[model samples]
Target: MRWVFLVLIVLNALYFVWEQQQPSVHVQQLPSVLNPAGVANIEVANATNSQTKTLDSVQAKINLTLLLGGFSDPALIDSLSQRLLSLDIDVKEVVVEEVDGVDYWVYMPPLVSRSVAVRQLKELKARQIQAYLINQGDMQNGISLSMLDTMDMAKDLVQKLANLGYTAEIKEVERKQKTYWLAVNSRSERLIDESLMTELTSDFPLMRYRQEMPQ
Candidate 1:
């Protein structure tokens, strides 16, 4: 009986030593908050901050203001304002005025000419053809010619008018005291014997005709 007990104790000791030498298997627990389909919240926050910084830098480069006047269309004003703002410009003011029976929009920065503005208004009006005279003092009038130089321009205009069934002639050319005067003879085939000379004279107020002595 004593010998059988010793052999059983030795077998138990060997099993315990084998179990301690064997490699153990471990199962890892995954985080419950992780989702494969969705983007991480931290990554989204970083991207938003980067985009905002880029927009702010782009806005700093542009600096121009415009003041619009005489334009009453809220839709037009809003569209124009938004477009300019998108380009990072500032609109300072807008004013509308009615002077001498004509509506006028005075715009600051003056991107457009008075004639162009008048034409736009007329198109909006959708009736009678509107004539506009731009105030030369308000804007730069580019490259004007003297009377001698104007004669060349006038000659071209007169020739073109003559080709379109109108009778026109440069009746006299006088170089007096270092100045030249051109007498223009104008008659219209369409309005025969019906004070065409008077009409021409009124149309060209700056021109003077040569007087003819009676024979």
Candidate 2:
């Protein structure tokens, strides 16, 4: 009876080994740990990475201020700002500053003879163009076509004079000048160029970014 029990035990062991080695006997796959706890940890890690990227992007952006110059009149500054605003620069970003500086003027040719000057004034009157007579001192024979409050006005006046068969030009002088400034907050300094602000102010050759434009 003991021998028979031993033989049966050996047979059971052999059967178990054969089953494990058989190609058809596949191992059962276990379920993955995708419970609320695991998902929560994944979400936390994603959130952390997103926050880090935001901080790095913020740090990369810089704030700069540009000072637009070459304007002696507030009208010119206003015009420039309006043009910039049309180019998508916010109106709030533009500001006018009054500072001590020199101004320019547009003047017609000085008549060599007083009689010719008077006759020219009469012609201008007939054409409905209002002009000032330089009725004093060495410039007495000169005709003041326009007093420049802005370069645009000066140019326009000159063009008007040209249309009327009169030659005109701008004259540089001295007085208080108005300046325009633009404050920019951007991811790149190149954004200013991309915004087309530079092209708009190109006529104002002196326009530039100030060392202390932050104020």
Candidate 3:
């Protein structure tokens, strides 16, 4: 009985060794979750990179202010500002007064009363002579003939008034000149467009411009 039991045990051990050397028949597949998760993460990272590039592109465009100036004529400045407004551009107008030089004012001495000044003004106008009555200041009730740049020009005007049977004198005064400017703000290339520049230069020969960056 003991011999038979030993033979049986030896046979069972040999069977276990044979099973360990054989290939598996009932194989189970993995869920493939890790590969899909990795792919999803990579896609999210790519999308984030794309968004960063888009933001960089937007940030690269600069907003600038263009200063258009060198204009002396008020009428021309008005025309230019209106033209720019029509193009849908943002524009701000600024008028600057500067001391140009001295001027000579040709006028008559103060009259006795406001009534006399008004009568003289009407008479001058009726005679086709342009004159203004000074209603205020030290020259109140006086007659203004013209504003001249030099004493010689004032004397000429005085002589002309004398020939018209009126007395005139000259006084020196400071001259103030006005300059017009436009500040245009935009983020596009419209400020430096060739055709627009050509149009502006053609219309206003003295129109000039410069650029100012934002802070």
| Local accuracy by lDDT, each model | 0.42, 0.68, 0.84
On lDDT, the leading prediction is 3
On TM-score, the leading prediction is 3
Better-scoring candidate (lDDT), 2 or 3: 3
* CA-RMSD of model 1: 28.0
- Model 1: which ten-residue window has the lowest total lDDT? 179-188
For model 3, residues 1-215, the per-residue Cα lDDT tens digits are: 99999999999999999999999899799885678878999999999999999987666545555778658887877888888888887778877676889999888889999999999999999999899999999989999988887899889888988898999889999988988888777643465588888988988888988665544
Candidate 1 per-residue C-alpha lDDT over 1-215 given as tens digits, one digit per residue, 9 for 90 to 100: 99999999999999999999999999999879868546667688889999999887665422212122223444544554454345444443333233322212221122266565554445423533222333456433211112223446657645654564333333223332221222112221222233744653454443233322211
Model 3 misplaced stretches (Cα beyond 4 Å): 1-98, 177-215
TM-score of 2: 0.35
- Give per-residue CA lDDT, model 2, range 1-215, as digits (tens): 99999999999999999999978867998777667888899999999999999987665443334454445555666676676566565533455555575555877667888888888888998899887778878778778876666777788888888988998779876565445555543423344574465576566565665533354
Put the candidates in TM-score order, highest first.
Answer: 3, 2, 1
Give Cα distance to truth, residue 63, candidate 3, Å. Answer: 37
Candidate order by lDDT, highest to lowest?
Answer: 3, 2, 1
